[model samples]
Target: MADVEYEPGSEAASNILKDLQEKLQTDTELQERAQELILNIQDIRASVNAAKAGAGTHRRGGDEVQLIAVSKLKPASDILALHAAADGGQVHFGENYIQELWKKHAILPTTISWHFIGGLQTSSISKLARIRNLYAVHSIDSAKKAVTLNRLRPDGFPVVNVFVQVNTSGEDSKSGVEPEVDGGELWDVISTIRKECPKLNLVGLMTIGAIARSQAAKEGEENEDFVALVKVAEGLEGRIEREEGVKVELKLSMGMSDDFESAIGIGAGFVRVGSSIFGARPKKADASIL
Candidate 1:
């Protein structure tokens, strides 16, 4: 695949679209699937926006809940199709695998904002930093990784926006700082990032919540994890403004494919949706590319 970056509608992108057209024309199944995905995304976007309107948060200059299409394990063609389906092109897409994201970033139009939404190793900071269009990173778990990313930011780029991941679920296997005020662990992480790393903007908090909590949320049972994240955000509000020396909307990014609407209703500034738009991904063994 070509590694050169292209602007949307440029000659290179046009060539890519030509190839995409050929693929879609030859594969009826893929064409139908792509169309279906586009409709699904549209519906989800409307629902999320509507929820935000009714939630009464946007009235105070709060950020509209952004839809980040999680594109991990899906083909780049799927991303391109979704981008083309929208008028302004899809502004945000999230990827977990570093190598896979890099490959897609190299080929996709630079207009698309790529967000790294996975557990990141400190070693990969330099590589990810080099991505020219990385809009934000959503899974920053520690002060160490945040410092590493700040130190390695690519030259000439503005600050890299980042979210401190809170393991609200309390899963031992999860990657995030514990959201506890008693010990001040979360405070230390956020304060250290803000005071020490000028290259990284401590923009928000994110969490996966517990797997069991997801079912509760689906059944309309209030998710304690989600509630915890909201409380964490509220608690940090004054500290965030004080530390930044300017009023900043410390966003909460705590929704997924299943409960994004619920998340939006609770003032989530961003929601990550994947399978509901792209359909089920193939088995892990099917993942190739980089």
Candidate 2:
């Protein structure tokens, strides 16, 4: 093909138009992705609404579901877009690894609140405590972890919000306090933290429901877990409130990308969503990435 020469102004205009077209296409794709997210969010919201309506029939407080988008393993760009869409609403973002979270927080604005959603080792507690906007630590299942967090909390912060993770399914490999109706040893641990660890606030309870093959199966199973967590929270609420002298709010941090709706229906104040919000994550090379 012969090279066709054009006037300088004409060539500039043509290049500008091509750039604009590409930008428009990129915007369209982004909008489409955002719309899909909004639909999924609406479905979750609807489930919470139905649960709230049903709660009125009973004498309990209506379901007040708080969606905590699990942003672990996703790119910072994706988190920024999701937060922009949220429009300043207080949305909780959950992270698994301390290093990954530190990187994300460094890049992301401090206004976005975060929850540490993974297992906490004694060593990492000091670093986790330093993050100013860390709203809650969801996997504080044992006294050891609680003590570590209490010791590491920065000065001037009244208390670090935390949840006692209860393993309702009794799986040995699961990461939570084994559910005890009497609150058993865990109760004593909570009391110790309350009394000794002046900087830590035992806010509520959390758990990971038994995994199921499909979304429907997951939802059915998680609903029971969610309800059980609520009962546990209600049971502990009286004692914790009386002792702490602060209204101990029961926050249920359950649900993944799969069964969030059911979790909300049973009153999950915070649902941790991962893949559904950020899309499938890239595979990690090793355990270090986690």
Candidate 3:
């Protein structure tokens, strides 16, 4: 794929984003991303939708899998192009950094649901809680962070949906709860969030499988961590019901650009995909928290 030049600060790009943001309510802003990238996104979406349709297990409903465009590091113009894609493109986008996420969110229309898919710093929580259209946070690894988010959530704001990020791979370098038979510390963190944080809606679990585990898995077999996340979700179900007295819908958020298809096959309700759609990112400082 050839690189498409998109100057985010250029007047043309500014006009483009502004025009799209203004026309969001009307149906006039249906222009797709740049041809090559648009086609790429379309192709990826078709493949994912097919996998969702053919899923033999974990079939929940018509709305089974959500394809979250991991828009971090990509230019705003690139994001706008993909958002203008024909098939519900302006829905979900995931960002990894606090500063970058807020910058994009401010420019994009509220119709675009933003997912904070990175580590949440203690200081950043208050600011994030104030964003009116933040749809979900895919990496809540600590009970204290959950509590802070809950308390700082803007008054009258809807409950912010969150997922307990479990370190299913047991990698010391990762920033998530260690996965175990009963979720180990994962259970305690989520349970505390559920009981104490009324402003937060504990929705599901998320995990970034270890690279080695992904490579070691055979073609027919799912990654060990991916399979473990499913079991951890299952184990937490009964306990969640017993403790909360409410049947919460728990979804699994796993997989990335490399293993989303396999993750979807197993039962990933949400997949954070990037390069396959937008092309590779330039090497830069890591944006992920912790």
Candidate 4:
């Protein structure tokens, strides 16, 4: 695979597209799926905004909820097809594996904003940082990782946007800090990022709610896991201002395709949708269900 970066529509990109024409031609179905999903996300955002307007208080995340098309294991041709047809907002794609992200980042158009939304390995921090088009990292769990990521940011690029992952599900299998005000783990991590990591922007908080909670959310019930993450974001708001001496409006990244609608209703600023948009992957049983 070529590791050279290419501008959209550049000769190199055109050549790549030429080489992948067969794949792109077959991606019409993928494009339709993505477009439909985009429309659904927009409709949900609009409905949520309207509700917030009526309630006069529910608004918390940003004005819009961003969708990150999780493209792990999917071919780059599929991404380009989706990008060509994407409407309404930026073409932000999420990847779970560092190596896959690295390779795709090398080949994909620079216009596509790549977000790392999986577990972060200390050894791969350098490679992850080397990605010039990295829009954000949604798996930041510790102060140590934050410091290393910040230190290794490519020279002259803008600070990386990052979400402090909080294991709201309280699952030992998840990677995140405890979202407890009393325990101070959440505060400690965010405070560290705010004070210590100059190259990282403390953008928001993310969580992979328990599968049961996600299912429950679809049945018109609040996902306790998402509720916890929102609380964490809320708690951080006052503290970020009072202690950090900066007015930071932390957002929430707590939804997948399964429960993204409710998450948006609850003020989630970012939602990662994969299977719903791309169909199931090669390995459904994989533990990293980002």
Candidate 5:
């Protein structure tokens, strides 16, 4: 993709964003894009709808499924093009790096609802909390991180949505709280969120399940990782209601580009799609979070 040339200034964000979106929406022949870079908003939306219609496990109805465009290694221009392709309505985007996330947030329209879907750590907690338009955080794996994030959230701001990441696949490389919740680490953190973290809204459970699980779902088998996430959500909801005296309906965030169709079909509240919507992204060797 060619570098997006636009005037720089605080006032120029919406203007530039709108201008780029208009041009891209109209497919104005300004620059040729790689075959992999083509934005396919229509196809992605249609596929999501189709999957929803065929959903056999959607618990809360198909209309509740939401798509979070996982634009991790993609550029701002591609985001603009996709936004334009959706007639400026598809605004939710997922990012991995705190640094890249903020930089893009600074340049893009604040109307965009950003979801941080990468590993959350102590070093980047404050910066992530400071994002003005952050819609949700899908990688909160620890209680301390959750507490600190809640404390760092700007005063008077609406509680930012939070999803407790669970390592359902039990993969050593994955980052999430363990699936156990019977007075274990997962239970402790969830309790902390409901009782101590007032600035954070515990909205759902998220997981980066094994690729094998994704493939298995496509083959008409159960994605145990997703099933585990749903179980956790149900367990937490019951516990929270009984102990904390708060009625809560936790959502599920377990689908990705590879298995989103099956995930939505299983009634996931949010599906993070990347390559299918914005095309394949080159690998990030040393992605910065600061």
Candidate 6:
């Protein structure tokens, strides 16, 4: 050790040097991670813009296309980050699982509206009905489900907005009503709700886009499917309006990360997005993640 006289500022200089060393170590990785997140955000914005542009010249009514960010199985932090970036309180989020949705709702601000985007069982009706800011329910495909929801809805709230899900592709495993069903049966179910269900408001119809492997194939196929669903909705719109004694504003809740542009172009008022905004989901331990 040099036992010579040390300079007066040596201790102060050493302390500053130590602080800088620690800060450099801590901030470099943090800055890199932040930069990566920014780049990802840019990519998401580009995709969204492309979708909006591809949607093309559809006369936007007073209502714009509402983007419901599907946050199923995603961490709450990711949702927070998205909310921070959004403007005009425009972000509406959707969740598939009841428990996860509840958890996220607990952590997220009340200002953000939540949509139940999954097939809701009767047992979960009470929990869903109690959520004060639930913007809409997108999977009310059956009269029974509608009845259950009507029964459980809390007093003093406006009727919960609901979309009748139609299975346009006629897939056996899918969870929506077939759009090409008997007219009597369809009208019976829909009319029953209009007459009887006081707490549920029939706002629109939702259908899944035809799932295809390639982007071009998916777009072409889904455009056909979307056009079909739109025709079905258009066919029923006047009927529902006549029965309800008011012009029913019908929303077509179709499209996802892949085919939303086509859906939008064909008049999708609501588009559900998940992986496109949150990035690729982490693979499940046993199941393949989509």
Q: Which candidate leads the pack in lDDT?
A: 1
Report the candidate with higher TM-score, 2 versus 4.
Answer: 4
Writing each residue's lDDT as its tens digit, candidate 3 over 162-229 gives 99998888788888987764655777788888789998888799999876777788878889888898
Cα RMSD for candidates in order: 3.6, 10.2, 6.4, 4.4, 4.3, 12.5
What overall lDDT goes with each candidate model? 0.79, 0.68, 0.77, 0.77, 0.77, 0.68
lDDT against true structure, model 3: 0.77
Clashes by residue pair, model 1: none
* Candidate 6 clashing pairs, residues 3+ apart or interchain: none
Lowest lDDT block of 10, candidate 6: 1-10
lDDT, model 4, position 133: 79
True-structure lDDT of candidate 6: 0.68
Model 5 stretches astray by more than 4 angstroms: 1-39, 56-62, 86-88, 217-219, 285-290
Deviation of model 5 at 105, angstroms: 0.4
List the candidates' TM-scores in order: 0.86, 0.76, 0.84, 0.82, 0.85, 0.76
lDDT of 6 at 10: 48
lDDT of 3 at 152: 90
Runs in model 2 with CA error above 4 Å?
1-43, 54-63, 86-90, 213-222, 238-249, 286-290
lDDT of prediction 1: 0.79
- Residue-wise lDDT of candidate 5 within 198-243, one digit each (tens)? 9998888899878786775646776888878878787888888888
- The digit string of per-residue lDDT tens for model 1 on 33-143 reads 778878888888888878777777543227467899999998877887788774556779999977778777766767788899999998788878877788999998878
Q: Can you give the lDDT of residue 284 in candidate 1?
A: 61
* Per-residue alpha-carbon lDDT of candidate 6 for residues 79-172, written as tens digits (9 for 90 to 100): 5545544343336889887666655564455677899989778888887887777778999877888888888888887678888888777778
**Count of backbone clashes for each model?**
0, 0, 0, 0, 0, 0
Question: Mind sharing the TM-score for model 1?
Answer: 0.86
State the number of backbone clashes in model 2: 0
